[model samples]
Target: MKLFTCTHCGQLLYFENSQCEKCHYPLGFEPKQLQLFPLVAEADGRTYRLFGTTQPNAPTYTYCRNHADGVCNWLVPAESATQFCTACALNRTIPNLSEPEHRLRWWKLEIAKHRLVYSLLRMGLPVVSKFEDPEHGLQFDFLADASQDGGQKVMTGHDNGLITINIAEADDIEREMARKSMAEVYRTLLGHFRHEVGHYYWDQLIDNTPHLTEFRALFGDEQDDYGQALQRHYDQGAPNDWSQHFISSYASSHPWEDWAETWAHYLHILDTLQTAHAFGLSVNPAAAPAELGLQAAITEEPYEISDFNRIMQLWLPLTFTMNSLNRSMGQPDPYPFIIMPEVVDKMAFIHKVCQQAGSSAKAAC
Candidate 1:
């Protein structure tokens, strides 16, 4: 979420900006350059702008064919044959854009997906779409079957590195129904991306890593029956002591559920805390339930990052305030999930994984 500039006019800009206000130059996000830069277009259809153009060709200019089609924000290297750019290249499947409104929804979905990728990239996680490496590379397909009243029913979840999201997630009513069905606190396009990516990284960061045993110790043996756990969860409901052992009632389903739920919350907390800091709210306090601040944090920096102590310190009070605010608005609590101390420890593990990946990506950069 760093500041970007207009490649042509040097206008201060945002990641989502489509046009530069000051210079009127078109703006886009270049994945390879990893910056918001300007573009130069020729009538023949090839479009590009110099890499670090304002700073001289630090690297060769990158091009995005989507820039021509007006769908993508990323840029690929000059020598790169891929037209979609690294981020867009990750798409295993997208909804049919022939319907027009589908394109708009698909556009919004891509924006959320890119934001998820940005956060993961910020944390240094590997994001290989299933297309990049069907055997081992992680990726997603934002597929929609016939889920709406008229559309086909598409499944939403992760499998063998592919995550299919019902395009109906873009439709308000369907999303709300699914949220109620799952009994989730926070359900959003971004949250889905984070949760599914968590599944992907379950392999990349934990299952494949040297700390596999430690992961098993914290989350318990993932070898336990998964499908059966879900069946039992739906049949018997969560245990009476769910609050004591699980963050969400759903987490009581299984270890994998526990992991994904915690992972999603970890992202939520970090992002919310970042927003808080950017808005100048209090950060990780020393004690629980500090005086609530209505304002967001002045400058976001995850205080306890990968450490349990600070996250707990910050989370307890912040969550309380979040709930209170929702109550004031007459809406359900924004974060219905809870995190026990043991769960806090697991979240710390996720922070560590993200930090390690971030370190690797930064070093390579």
Candidate 2:
């Protein structure tokens, strides 16, 4: 995510901000421009025009219908027939809003989902909603478990193209307990979205392509029985040398999981690196020796960078700086995993997959 500014007041703004605090200007994101524009209401009171523009035919826009529920702030062209923005359109089921607590949880989940969508759009990846392509499009369901509603437990996983997330995970206490129980170093709503969506993309981008051969060589064959693989993983646990190739213990459960885990880490790296680049952040401590190789800088967007090595070069130093800041505040490391040589090879494959997808989209255009 990149830093944004209010066009009306030049005040620094965040990705999710709906109004500029300094100027009280209404704001809406322009997806085509990738900008958070200060909005001016149109004469009919149904559309908005950009703050600095005065053209009679300036593009008009309106907030997605989800905005009325306070769960989404994304905008759509006024001329668009769809009521939801690209991101909100992916939602197959939302928590029942009649329950007061469910509203807040839905809002939290939307924040994370929007961020995930933003990154996907930035990478020029396919993001068709289930409504657009019912058979293969991506979709989401925010569901409640048996504890909340005498229903079957909702597991956070992807099947075909639909991803189901238990609304309980949105509760901070519940999420923290699960994190500790699994002995995981890091976990969050955004991480869950990223990881599960990775499964969806694997089906779309690599399943029947030539890339599958390379994917299997690096991540292993995904044809193995998933349920049995997970059973063995929980019963015996990952081997001591798991980190030599896998990104997480859970990743070792199956080849599909390893790909999903690596894919999520790839998104984490690209998004964080882009944020650092937008802010012109550099990690160069004078006291740190050159041989330590902890000094680095980012001058380009990670999504556009074809070289995976360059992305890692900036990522390592950026993580070092981020972890140090977390420690200063007596918090756990923001990024708790190390990228080994074997893992980098897998990440490179993912990088190529994304680059190829982007190129194919452009060529079709």
- Per-candidate Cα lDDT values, in order, are 0.71, 0.91
User: Residue by residue across 1-365, what tens digits does model 2's lDDT show?
Assistant: 99999878889999998989999988888776778889999878878988989888878999989988877768899999898998999999999988888998999999999999999888888889989999889999999876556667788999999999998889999999999999998889999999999999999999999899999999998999999999999999998899988999999899999999999999999999999999998889898998888898778888888999999999988998999899999999999999999999999999999999988887887
| Most accurate candidate by lDDT | 2
Give residue 191's lDDT in candidate 2 (0 to 100): 92
Using alpha carbons, what is the TM-score of model 2?
A: 0.97
Off by over 4 Å in 2: 148-151
In angstroms, the error of model 2 at 212 is 0.7
lDDT of candidate 1 over 1-365, digit per residue (tens): 55576756777786777678897766667664456776664334455565345444444444556555456667666666676666677777777777776787787788778777776666666767656677877666667666468876677788867778877787767788988887766578878777877787787777867878887888888898999989999999999998887678877788888888789888888867765654556534445343553222434367336565665666666777878778999988887766777888888887877787778787987
TM-score of each: 0.83, 0.97
RMSD of each candidate?
A: 3.9, 1.2
Question: After superposing candidate 1, which stretches have Cα over 4 Å from the reference?
Answer: 1-12, 38-45, 50-63, 67-70, 147-152, 283-300, 303-308, 317-332, 360-365
Q: What's the distance in Å from true for residue 182, model 1?
A: 3.4
Clashes of each: 24, 0
Q: Point out the worst 10-residue segment of candidate 2 by lDDT.
A: 145-154
